[model samples]
Target: MTHVIDPAELKRWLSDGAEIAFLDVREHGQFGEGHPFLAIPAPYSRLEIDVPRLVPRRTTRIALIDGGDGVAARAAEALRDIGYTDVSVSRDGVQGWQAAGFTLFKGVNLPSKTFGELVEHALETPHLSASELSHRLDAGETIVILDGRPLQEFHKMSIPGAICCPNGELARRFWDLDISPETPVIINCAGRTRSIIGAQTLIDIGVPNPVYALENGTQGWYLQDLPLNHGQSQTYRQIDTPPAEAVLTRAEALANKSGVERVDSRTLDGWAHDADRTVFILDVRSPQETAADPVPGAIPAPGGQLIQATDQYVGTRGARLVIVDTDGVRAPVVASWLRRLGHEAYVAARTDLPAASHADETLPLLPEVQPADLFANGEPPRLIDLRSSASFRQGHIEGAEWSIRPRLRPEPNQTVVFIADDPAVAAIAARDISAERGAAFRLAGGPQDWEQAGLRVVATPDTPADDDRIDFLFFVHDRHDGNKAAARQYLEWETGLVAQLDADERKLFRLPGIA
Candidate 1:
């Protein structure tokens, strides 16, 4: 009974600055395969759990799409059931949007990536190609390579002699860089976007060094058959110097340009008491720093990733964002970027904020049935494997059917048992299933437990087509199968993003002087 919106009208609404949540209700993996550029991931399975956090306001315009999977209709119903006042589905889902001749973005965080592209186009960010940089390194040129990716990513693989100076810390730790102004500094990421943004960040902060992004980044290096150093762990630590006056002035100017607001502890406390508003207080610092001396209640989200994947962290578009940093430099810079994205962001530095327990504090332990017990029961429970589709196909219990967490539909008479890699996800799936069906249980340990218990598992020869919905698009290097083809495809996809931005006339991203 949900109303349907035509793709043309939706596009018009976007062009008109309509306040709406355009959500793709397919699984995250499926959504990642291809989707409308602005469509946020709101998989049909977790609609009830995710929508409230994402939209918050009951009257917000909500448009659901499923790429013709038929999940959109069900998701639309669920939204209405949860008291959402305005809800509708795309006329033909994602296909409808495409059939209407609108652009469909292939990756998550399109806004951030598009912004990076715009930055490169407008500012003409400097770059050093893989071959050129490799030759310079071989000749022992006076250069410093700073990897802008996270420490974990840096640990996996990096160009030789690259130091980890993750975004946000670049300005704060500039003096610690310990290089002459004439030294050529290079920055890189897994791909192009972060490399462009990171290099531009240093340039904007007025670093005297001649900065350049490693053209096309690590993928470019791999494509050129260049060697990469694995298991490298060079990282820059904070020097704890008082915030420099010049850096503070730069942050203030940027904040003023973006019209970012400022908040105190009292204002934050008042917002926390408002039931109608959703506020996210985040600590924009390095993982090592946050771990050593944690801030209570403030979620740990490094500034770069927060900007790169804002949808993942802050679901509600109109929600208030409070950024925290021990040094004044990082928070204001992050707030400035958030403001550019049309968020009501505030920068604050206060030690009196309330403390919150760890995010994983209160997980309920579900009743678990051992694999041996499950097989020997009078009536074996219906096995529901909650692993990724790709993982399930690799090896699963002989009769187990692959299932997603939020979309599990247990039969009233069936005794269901949930299995997943993580016990926490499995426990939640069990609880949700039990709410609908009379009884549900979880496997004691997970798939590993089944194998250790000498249970028979079979691998399917057929590669399941990722047609209906894919929840995850595992990085090529991260995939246990080591799909070099996936890596190539990802690089190709990323390479084309700049051109896509050029064609899309609706994007509103603006760099300081570029727009």
Candidate 2:
């Protein structure tokens, strides 16, 4: 049976110093528009698939919030079916929270973005305007630009000649860069938070070279009509050698300053066995590094992305985070930032961690029908495309209808076939449909299989329509697609995030020298 908690009770639970997975089960677009400050987006479409990764401890207290659409109750049932023990639904959902007078924040990554703004305000992190940087470049000044975003984002667009050195790797790899201490360095991201956080990261580590965040990052550069390099691959090279003693010392000192705990395997094991607390064993290294040296039960969360999008990885608000890495430098650096971000973060060596069991639940297999077989019976089966609306707009099997789990409905006698990139989504959707209707089959090998079979495909830009694309967030998406007005609006939203926070929300940040 599912329990029901009111918004006031949920709010109190969040501040009670207990691990609680306050999840918003609304779609990405709805969740991005507004949600409780501590709410993590676990859409109803991918609730089962994401819950295992977000809240590893099945017994962890979870409260599901929706947009008064009854999705939370459905999510609660799904979680219980997947071995989740303690789960509840927020009474009346987001509407209830607002009715209780709590703030519903706009935008994703509220905590990280707000903390970035607070860091800039408290530390007065120096920055350079786009026009100033442009003039300096024209003057042939010795300056280096480091793009703080991940390589994928950097590849899309970046400052000309900027190197992709994510903020997490800056402290560890700065000494490896063949640059003189005299050369000035500037760190930038797509917007304000990362640029400020990345630049301030270097300053906090006491780098000898002058450092500044590109004010407003790529958006700022674009607003100035400056050219951005596309399809760039320039990035910091990975070094097998351990960091220098000085670099390690700096990382350690910064972590200590932030009061990040240093724990060994024994402590981690004890915490893991503690039934009352939720502990996350995160391997904060590059994906390649983590794959090369796999740590048992460790979730791969690159350090930079972990800090920038903590909600994506961690769902429990007050859980203990044990960050692991092969080297001494990366974990400490990440833990320092996570500490400042108001998490109970710890650093541990990969060699010291003991093997632990990981979740291995497999999706139930669905009956598959070959693309050619789909056409053998003169009339084709009703095709339900479970892919993203954006992908559906780009191209899809002709006659297929795009739908997500929440909106999918098929007739009891209809022959429905699901086409999806992730088989799990199709499986879950099929399960739901089959419970009410008859059994449903999936397209063998998805749309690619249909294309290879000489089937007709079509593109319909207006098929799902903009309003129905709840999985996509168009608010900050258009900025990179040459929408100057959208870019300006995004920057304004980021800069104004601090003023939107209430007193309790502002108290979550723990900056240096600030009580």
Candidate 3:
């Protein structure tokens, strides 16, 4: 029989030494708009296929939640249909969790804790925040406002004088940017993750000074209504419309006539090694995808956001660039987009990849899976989770140590398993991590796959333990911060959601002053 724990009790349990799998079966928009910090989102409709591909553990407990849309039970039933043994719905699903007094977060990721890690790391390396950045700009600090968005976006609207090229090429063609690392490199996106990842990438790859995210990029700029670049928002018009076939023919002719060399992936990777050369390697993938299997030295700027956010990326006014992607298609689009903006650009090709797949999409992979107990076996490879940061932090394999910051260039020193919400991204990340560091990597069976595979997941208590192990209950004082956040975050946990994880026998840790 499944256990039903109340919101207060559940948080305590999680903070203790338990390992629990969190789920929110709400619709995509609802899930995207707001959810708990740790709950990995699996839309009620796509659970069947996506679950198995994402979660690979067989021993994890399932925490099923919903918006009380009569789908919680159905989702749980589906979990059982898919062979999940330990499943329970939120007390009243989303309603109950919310009623319990937990705060919900808004973003594409749940357990929004990992973003903190990204920020911390970026800050660690000569980074600055939006507020701090404003001071520098006002004071005339020699700075580089790089729009990590694509060229079209840069042309459409961006901070005046910011260049394009998106996040993907920050390191791929760092030398191409031709600015001293000491020049403050500030990056921005429409919102958060991309900018966070982009800024972190520069710091991780040994950029001389600090890097920063504009916090909220163009939108923030607009929300503040501070000197808008309100030209027609034709961010992609130049790149998308193209310069006609004749223009492309002319460029091809120029390449042929000038005999300029076009290098492949392996050759480009070799060229990128020289510190003297500035190569900003751009990986064209979503921030979440980049998190799962990031190109160790590559910066991410998703294809869609590239255009509008370009001005925030290109660093200085006139920077050359080399763009990369999972395959060659995205690179040229971005490269050509940059060229249209009058920035020197090219797609460094790769032979190992087919013409269709031949760009700087190269990334590292994870090590093979030896179960979460790999540590108990005495040969613990560093346990790095590919799951979204919030998901990993709110709860994950007990005792598994993780570096919240996404690896810009992963080294191949240890065995690693890539656990994520998507198998494709996990597989790719694992493969890239492996390829780069030559480390052993494997895909964590995904959420549904874990239960279907009959793997065991420890139940996460809603509380913390003295030894830092996750238990079943973290007591909510009358006026504590945890009391508020947890209440709003797991509104449904108090009702049906709480019923799933609550256990009277699973007591919580009380404070010294508690009666």
Candidate with maximal TM-score: 2
Best by lDDT: 2
* Cα RMSD for predicted model 2: 1.7
Q: Rank the candidates by lDDT, best first.
A: 2, 1, 3
The residue pairs found clashing in candidate 2 are none
Which digits, one per residue and each the tens of the lDDT, describe model 2 over residues 27-67? 89889888999999999888888988899888999999999
Candidate 1's displacement at residue 132, Å, is 1.3
Per-residue CA lDDT of model 1 for 203-321, tens digit only, reads: 87778999999987887887787888899999886588777788888877777777887777788778867756667788888887889988877778898888877777766555688
Better of 2 and 3 by TM-score: 2
Whole-model lDDT values for every prediction: 0.76, 0.88, 0.49
Model 3 residue 313 distance off true place after TM-score fit, in angstroms? 25
Query: How do the residues 129-219 of candidate 3 rate in per-residue lDDT, one tens digit apiece?
Result: 5556666778988887777665655655676545554665554444445587678777765444456555755554445765776765554
| Stronger candidate by lDDT (1 vs 2) | 2
TM-score of each: 0.86, 0.96, 0.41
